[model samples]
Target: ARAYRMEWPADMTVFEIDQPQVIEFKATTLAGLGAAPRAELCTVPIDLRQDWPKALLDAGLDRNRPIAWIAEGLFGYLPPAAQDRLLDNVTALSAHGSRLACEAVPDMSQVDHDQAREMMRRVTAKWREHGFDFEFADLGYEGERADVASYLDNLGWRTVGKPMSRLLADNGLAAIPQSNDSVSVADTVYYSATLSK
Candidate 1:
């Protein structure tokens, strides 16, 4: 949606997909603001757990055209199997030159699950004090999950993984200080890859 607000070339079309409630909220808010999107924007309201490809196609997505797909802040919320399924669908729909960028969680094998859960509990409690009541631990699937970059590599995609610290520095930003509550910040990696096959 933010991309659509920017005045890009007319040939480019931006599509935003999300759950029905989120789509509804965005639509309503835009309507209330009377701010129209600058470029062609399509919003597809479909659950990720369901057939999203069909929904996207119905919304006028061109499967033959190359696309830049972003999966930021999403994979951790889904189980490992679901993540694989989503990638499979994406690979099937993507054209030869399509690109994919994602933020992936670090390997959890070395971390203590109990300690992680406790940390999340404290974070959740802090959020609850401000009005949001939700279990942060329950929101994510924590276990031995496939390394996203490796999975993409095996699927014939050329992958490049950048650690969060390096990424920040590359953008002329300082890295965050090391702290107990900063494990996630330190562990996250960003990936940018292109389909080669």
Candidate 2:
């Protein structure tokens, strides 16, 4: 599959395309709208939530080489068990010094089911109209989930950085007028964290 934002040279070996046309079009549009280093159209079957390291291993890609994996806007779609499973797979296939970057939706323990469903309804209007019918539970790492930082640290990764509310405020990000809980009962509990090996 083509790597977006990757820098390519004239002599660089290029791979074939294997993703959907819509994704390719979106990638190209993104590249056009932003200063992405370089991107190629590919013919890869893209599975955002798949066990990617296994896929690479099955494809004969070396597991010993450091790989950079990014999961954006995906953590919220998985259940807690699946989240752990995904992380386990990452640890299994990642060589020393491999890096991962992702955004997670944190826990939604405080949310009422009715509100959550209503929110989902509004968000999934298009899909629902297209015949989709499924309810989702909180799919992110609760700060309490096995002490995520420590778990990863034990797995050889280190807590590197995070954009906590205090950090954001220090960086001139104005605090919200009121507590997030007051604004939205379904608000998540934890700030995003970054970990690296």
Q: Which of the numbered candidates is closest to the native, going by highest lDDT? A: 1
For residues 1-197, could you state the per-residue lDDT of candidate 1 as single tens digits?
Answer: 67536777878788888999998998888889887887788888899998999999999989998888989989989999899888888898889989999988878888888888998999899999999988999999977889898898888789999999889889999887887753577679999989987
Model 2: ten consecutive residues of lowest lDDT:
182-191
Alpha carbon lDDT of residue 150, candidate 2?
A: 53
In model 1, the number of clashes is 0
Q: TM-score for every candidate vs. truth?
A: 0.92, 0.57
Where is model 1 more than 4 Å wrong at Cα? 4-7
Give per-residue CA lDDT, model 2, range 1-197, as digits (tens): 23555666654333332235765776578668774435433333456366555555555555676655555555565566666676678777777777766554544555565665655556567667889765433332333244445556667776553534544567897664454231142232232233344
Alpha-carbon runs more than 4 Å astray in model 2: 1-44, 48-51, 58-60, 119-147, 160-164, 176-197
lDDT of 1 at 151: 91
lDDT score at residue 80, model 1, on the 0-100 scale: 91
